[model samples]
Target: MSVIGKMLTLLRGSARELGESVVDANATRIYEQEIIDARNAILKAKSELTGVMAKEMQSAREIERIRAEALRLEDLALEALGKGKEALAEEVAVKIAETEQQLEEQSRVHADYALQVGKLKDLIKSAEAKVREHEREVAIARTTESVYKATRSISDNIGASGSKLLNARESLDRIKRRHEELADRMAAAESLDKETGTRALEIKLAEAGIGGDAERARRVMERIRARKTDAEGQ
Candidate 1:
């Protein structure tokens, strides 16, 4: 294809894709709206069917009236014949024939109306059932979509928390390592002080004859001697 033709084709394809995307995003809402439309259509059809049924009833009533009139005419004709009025009976017979013909026509009309009503009722019933089925499917789809979204959100939150937890663990490890290092340093400092400064002080005191078991024993002997001297003076 030429460049311009290819461009047009690409544009059309893009448009179609965009339309499909929009449709997919609003699929549940669209599905619900379609069901509503179907229900409305069924309601309208039912209304029409009601009208047809009314016509059928009217036709049936008309047929009944005609049959009643025909029966009355037959009775009148029999009475005239019993009374020897041949001409009057013949006139009544003509009317009976006309009434019967009208009854036939009205019956046909009633039959047609009845047939139409039956077919319409069946169609409406089928349509309603189909719409109901579609509605159920839409409900299922919506629930599934909601659950999927909730699950995905939970998964994302867990992923984020996992990262934060890892960071926290690393921070704790660093803090522990620092504390351990500080404790080791403190221990080393105490050991050095005991080894160097404390030993030096001990040596100094010992050279002055003031910090040993021998010095303690000498002090004790002097105190005992002083006490004995005081006792003699008393």
Candidate 2:
């Protein structure tokens, strides 16, 4: 491939990887937000279902009222016929027919609305179940994500602490070596203290004002001599 083509290909690959990383980082938040949106949808559906149910209830009452009116009209028509009033009976018959027709029509509408209510309720119930399942799954996902992040953090710490650990180990070894060297020197000093000529050497070294002042040692020696002289004189 040409250099330009290769560069373009590399750029595309980099972009794709970047996009994927961005998506992965935000995936949990996106999923949580999506669950929230779904819950909102459920609420909206429930609201709509409530409206449908209310309308269904109104339709039921309407059907009941229509049936009652039709029964009253039937009784009026029968009474008028029994009274030997032909014109009145005819008018009551017309009213009865109209009422019956309306009752039939309203009955059909009421049944349709009843069916609709049932279907909506079932649909809402199913949606609610699905939402609950998603909620559980999202919770699991979140927990799993947390665990993964924690593990990743620990791994990163362990990896990055390599240099610090190495340095600390080297420091400890150096301290141990130094301690051993100091122990050897202390042992040598003790050995020197046991030597036959070491006391005369230490006196000379002390008189040179190395570890303590020669003037202080002379003053201490003078006090001891004076006490001896006083005892001898007594």
Candidate 3:
């Protein structure tokens, strides 16, 4: 790879790491907040339950006081009845029955409130567990995402390097072709030089008025005729 390509690869790797770090940090914050909210909800539910219990206790005390008062009134009515005050005794009996019914209703209400508080605690626990599971999922997703990003970055970098190498090869091919063309031109020039030298020698001989000798020309013609005769015989 070229220097620039190496640098790009390094930069892409760093970017992937940075992205992963950011996701991890965000996930941590989200998980922390979820935990805090769940804990707060649990604390609030407990506090409310504490207050409800205190109220229930007060109600119980009031019911006990009413029972005591009803007994005292009954005792007074019985004493009066023994003295022939039957109407006063009947009034006291009615008041005692009404107070007993009110106490029963208050007890039922207190029990219902306690049940509701228990359900709230269960819900908080479930929510906290869900938050933890979600955090784990987020961590896994971040890991996969980081791996995918890094792989993609590396693949792209490798592809770019391959393209550059191909381009370099093409450039070298062009240089080689240019060199071949120059060599061919040189060869042509050399051939032309040889041709020019031959033509110049012919002109020099003609200018010097040098013609072939009669005896030599006759000998050369005899050799040609002999060759033609041999071909005909064959």
Once fitted onto the true fold, the runs of candidate 2 whose alpha carbons sit more than 4 angstroms away are: 1-30, 159-234
Model 2, span 86-173: residue lDDT tens = 8998998888788888888888888887888788778778777766765665565455446556666776797888833357788999
Ranking by lDDT: 1, 2, 3
lDDT of 3 by residue, 10-57 (tens): 446755555534344565577668767866776786787677667767
Top candidate when judged by TM-score against the true structure: 1
Return the TM-score for candidate 2, rounded to 2 decimals: 0.54
Each prediction's whole-model lDDT (CA):
0.79, 0.73, 0.70
Q: Which structure is stronger by TM-score: 1 or 3?
A: 1
lDDT of 2 at 120: 75
* Model 1 backbone overlap count: 0
TM-scores of all candidate predictions against the true structure: 0.57, 0.54, 0.41
lDDT against true structure, model 3? 0.70
How much does candidate 1 score in TM-score?
0.57
Candidate 1 lDDT tens digits, 1-234 = 443453345346754444323223466678788898889989999999989988998998898888889888999999999999999999999888888888888988998999999999998998898788767756655554465566667767988787533577889999999999999999999888876887777877877887686699899999999999999999
